[model samples]
Target chain A: MTLGRLNHVGVATPSIEKSIPIYRDLLGATKIHEAFDLPAQGVRVCFVDTPNSQIELIEPLGETSPILKFLEKNPLGGQHHVCFEVPDIHAAKAEMEAKGAKVLGEPRIGAHGTPVIFVHPKDMGGVLVELMEAPKREH
Target chain B: MTLGRLNHVGVATPSIEKSIPIYRDLLGATKIHEAFDLPAQGVRVCFVDTPNSQIELIEPLGETSPILKFLEKNPLGGQHHVCFEVPDIHAAKAEMEAKGAKVLGEPRIGAHGTPVIFVHPKDMGGVLVELMEAPKREH
Candidate 1:
């Protein structure tokens, strides 16, 4: 299974509003998409376009948000996960399991509307990794 | 200062040797570079090339390594910092300072042999960001 791409770096922030300027003003990112809430994922997300990949800014959406614990520890936000695109999600999952890497949960539709799954940090050398199914090209 | 690329995502690990297989076997990364020690920075480093960017795996090289405290906090290792390339390192440093972001230190030759500076995490919305000067083009 060849890794498709370094899709994006997930950053958990307390406030996407507070984070935008750093990417736009400081990093000179010209194409930052509007922030939106992903209720299913329990986070609000915005994509900051870079020449090659993107910076995914994620903010907690509800009190029970998954990232709340992370924010509680960090208090100021930080890198949460790094996503890599894969051609096939199920194959990737099977390979991971076969290799003794634990998948956090079944693949679900991610922020980009593509199937994605998270690998446990312990299995991923302490960094949470998200394997996202690559979007199909229009014929 | 337009961001040139999402140069690499830095992952702090206890051992780069242990980290290489996850990238090569699990992620199917074919271009795993040789791990080498950077004595000046007190870390051993390796590059896992993705199609668009790279994942920099860094391990503490000595007892005085800068990432020692981080490793102490996160025993399993974790995402450390994200590096972005800029056309001019000096201009990027000045702009960050003007925006009230504290530059970690004077721009110094970084892992890639280009001048780079780190912006304080507090100023970058709780994320540590490295600004690297784009490599000069060979004419």
Candidate 2:
């Protein structure tokens, strides 16, 4: 259960459209991906690719979206959770729990279409950490 | 000024010592570096290496440390900033200002001893972004 590559850093944003130029023009990021909605996750997500790892821009999709609370606290949005790849999702979850870290919920399919589980921020140095099974191929 | 590698994600902590175990034992991170103080930045920093990038654990070095204000707002501490490498610091700064992004201050030597500048989070999709001159050789 060694630490793996950082998959991406999730950033909760109020508007993905407005945020695109910041990455594209300001940062000279040319590989900006299109924004899409994940109804089950209750968020619209976009990926801005860096040479290594990515920045995931997420916006609320519905009234009950979890990002709504974070937005309430930070009207302008902010850095959300960081996702890391793991060899096995179930093994990672068991290791986390055994180490006395709180797993947010049972392993479930994440936006990357792989099983993932989130570890509680309070138990993970105040950083919400998402552990996802490594994708079968480059995404 | 094209986007380079995702260098590291900075995590502010009240105590770097307390945060080490979280990355080490809990996440099975083996390449945790020794902590050191950067009096100029007023933060004690440590690096935890992952396959792709690194996680920087920062603890306030003194009462006047800038991180103190952030810690006051987020008592448990949290993700502070994300650093990206650039081929040229001056070019990146000019490009950002030209794009209407507010660069926090003139480029200065950062903890990594490289010229770096920070963009205002308000203008960066609510993410504090640090742009550093790519190191001459990997640290």
Candidate 3:
């Protein structure tokens, strides 16, 4: 199998509240989700639905947040990572490791409520990539 | 209308030749376009077709290639910009400007052969956003 589809693009923002207006008013996005904190991930996130994908806006939750370093260099905010869907995250991780790509950690529940893993940017040509298991559809 | 769809993610690479194997053999991508130079934009580009979108691999075309600076900061390369499709480039430009987002330059032809413009990263929360007119689909 191959990459399933683009799930979302993670944008690291200093203030999700400040950024919400741009996506909502300027871009005319109507399907934006309410902001929620992912305590484990140490970031507050909300999804802005696009025609084919979502923009995941993230803000550091507290001190020692993983995204703090990213924000330190880019105080205003910046694109953090690009997330893609995979039919099976385990298989996707296996395949990537076989090609010498560094899988950050074991598959864990991600913002999408699906098993996900991050690949090191160095391995993916300087782009931090997130691979999530595609959500199953019920008939 | 809202952002039509994510068209492609532009990645700056030192060498497109070197990155192809990872996306193809590793990621199982099969529909990669041949690499070509776009002197006007000061870079070479190639598209790796994903299931729902594309990853545009771009390399500096010459000594004065604009991407050279990005490559310097990220010697191994990095995600440069994410492009989205719009129904009307002019309307999108107007909406962004009205919202106080700086749209760079006049709309011009982009790598997709459609009129496109870039929103300054400062205005876009540190992520350079490219808005391209949606390409016509062939029946």
Candidate 4:
């Protein structure tokens, strides 16, 4: 239940390439990180850095990708979930479970290379919530 | 379309009273400000301050409230929209217009008593985005 920061907002896009101009030209956003394909997650992702947090643009990797299903419903894509940082993944998972929340699965490595898990939207006020362990601070 | 900072994530709830326990007991969230009503907006809102930003719990104030439509589709409530701060509302509006983004209406006073406007979601990757004029720093 302890949260550190809002790392990013997961945005589902039909095509990350096509969506770039909207954020760049219309929003005046620069410094977009290179897009990457995360096979384990069945999606391609690009991080658009904002001053305080990031907008994670995600695209389906294949026809069978879950993101494809989401896109089928929305067509144009939409907000998928919000990711927040927690100091400890295991503890956060346990805390959420203790309060009767439904965690989708065990903690798995996410796009940021940090352990992450998603809480079911039904148990989270109809909003799919992602909790990720913050990258360890370099001393 | 320049942005200042993330002000808060707007969450639509059927009842803020029922939703409080979820955030407070489950999410370990504290520092919930007193709930207030915005007659013009026709919604009651409460700001739950988080480590970095805030979660805005909004409930329709009356049958004519606009939030009613959102709640009708999502009875249990859900993440509504995300708000970002803008240094200058007028300039940001012009910038978004220059690139063909649809601004919902003229600048109006938002919950925080600052000028704000909503960008049509169709142009924003299916996300309803709010742009608020940032509060000037006290020198």
Compared with the true structure, model 3 gives a TM-score of 0.95
For residue B38, model 1's alpha carbon misses the true position, in angstroms, by 1.4
Q: What does candidate 1's lDDT look like per residue over A1-139, in tens digits?
A: 8877999999999899988988888888999998998999999999999999999999999899999999999888999999999998999999999989999989999988999999999988899999999998699
lDDT of 2 by residue, A43-128 (tens): 99999999999999999999999899999998888999999999999999988999888998799888888999999999977798
Question: Which 10-residue window in model 3 chain B sums to the lowest lDDT?
Answer: B21-30
Better of 2 and 4 by TM-score: 2
Q: Residues B47-80, candidate 1, lDDT per residue (tens digit)?
A: 9999999999999988999999999999889999
Q: Which ten residues in a row have the lowest lDDT in candidate 1 chain B?
A: B32-41
Query: Could you tell me the C-alpha RMSD of candidate 2 in Å?
Result: 1.6
DockQ of each: 0.87, 0.85, 0.71, 0.64
Best by DockQ: 1
Off by over 4 Å in 3: none
- Kindly report the fnat of each predicted structure, to 2 decimals: 0.91, 0.82, 0.69, 0.53
**Of the pair 1 and 3, which is ahead by lDDT?**
1
For B30-131, candidate 4 gives per-residue lDDT tens digits of 688889998888899998877778788999997799889989888988878888898889998888888788999899899888999899889998888889
**Model 1 spans > 4 angstroms off:** B137-139
Flag regions of model 4 displaced more than 4 Å.
none
Instruction: For model 1, name the residue pairs that clash.
Output: none
Q: Which candidate is the best by lDDT?
A: 1
lDDT per residue for candidate 3 within B37-124, as digits (tens), equals 8887889999998778888999999899989999999998888988889899999999899879999989988888899999998888
